[model samples]
Target: MPVKYNVTERKNLQDPQAAPKFYASAKADGEVNLKSLSKEIAGGSTTVSDTDVLAVLNDLIKVVSRHLADGKIVKLGDFGNFQVSISSDGAETAAKVTSSLIRNNKINFRPGADLRDMLSTLKYEKYSR
Candidate 1:
């Protein structure tokens, strides 16, 4: 009879492909899209269909607007909070405001406990020469 361990020995495992290269490629694509969007918006010569932009913008507006209207805080898992905070006096001066007006309603999401625990428990192994 032989003793069995739950953890697999490192010597029996295969090496994994590098993940950073994939992440860099994805990030580069996002940057390219942003630059193209900026150029189109600035040039004004290229006509972007209103329906396409409106659909995306409206979806975003609906999420925030609905949550605020319902007086509920919208929580996005792994992201931090969105809530409506009120200010009073209608004065532009920060010192003069005293909780009289519903000045801004925003979304805030605090990361869930499970996500925090998982992040905290992450471990890395170093390869020896």
Candidate 2:
């Protein structure tokens, strides 16, 4: 199946006076939450129940969160890697920068081989709203 995309109008932020430009952005058909995702996983395994999958996924999230907070990168094999990213204020010198200079932290996910391959071969179709 082809991926769905919607046309979007964007501006050049630096040159606000420039004419608007149109681009194609991928649009999700729908989203699956933990419960729905777990059911799908269970469907692929005869021995695993949806409840079992959900429990394991919940624990995985907790463990991953703890590892990230401890400054560790969590790698889920071919699933991807997750790490904490920080945006900080600049300091005149390296010595002048401290934890106080840190602005905010965000989780960054770098997709693994499977997702990269999917992206490489994806076909797109313009979505009609």
Candidate 3:
């Protein structure tokens, strides 16, 4: 399926007084929750049930969270790698830098080869209400 997008008008934040520029923004066609996603996975295999997929996925989330808290990068073979990233306030000296200065901590994901390939080959379509 092609990705759907809609036209939008955007103003440059740095120059708000400038004329608005037109752009294409991706619009979500829909969202799939765990149960729905599990069912889809189950359909691709004969041995797996939706419930089993859901249980494993739930456990995956917990396991990933635990590993991340331990300062480890979690790499899912063909999916992606997740790691914690942070920005911090400038420190006057190396010795003065500490965790307290850390801000805007976030998890960052770098797409794996399979995902990168899929993204590279994606097709798009303009969406209308």
lDDT of each: 0.52, 0.96, 0.96
Estimate the overall C-alpha local distance difference test score of candidate 1.
0.52
lDDT string, candidate 3, 1-129, tens digits: 999999999999999899999999999999889999999999999999999999999999999999998999999998999999899998989999998999878999999999999999999999978
Off by over 4 Å in 3: none
Cα lDDT of model 2 by residue, 98-129, tens digit? 99999998999999999989999999999997
User: Which scores greater on lDDT, model 1 or model 3?
Assistant: 3
TM-score of each: 0.28, 0.93, 0.92
Task: Give the poorly placed runs of model 2, Cα more than 4 Å off.
Answer: none
How many clashing residue pairs appear in each of the predictions shown? 9, 0, 0
**What is the Cα-based lDDT of residue 55 in candidate 1?**
59
Q: How large an RMSD does model 2 have? A: 1.2
Q: Please, what are the lDDT tens digits per residue for candidate 1 over residues 13-95?
A: 35455332211111111133444554555467456654555555568668877887787776765554567655434777778
| Alpha carbon deviation, residue 91, candidate 1 (Å) | 17
**How would the candidate models be sorted by lDDT, starting from the highest?**
2, 3, 1
- State how far residue 73 of model 2 sits from its true place (Å): 0.7
Better of 2 and 3 by TM-score: 2
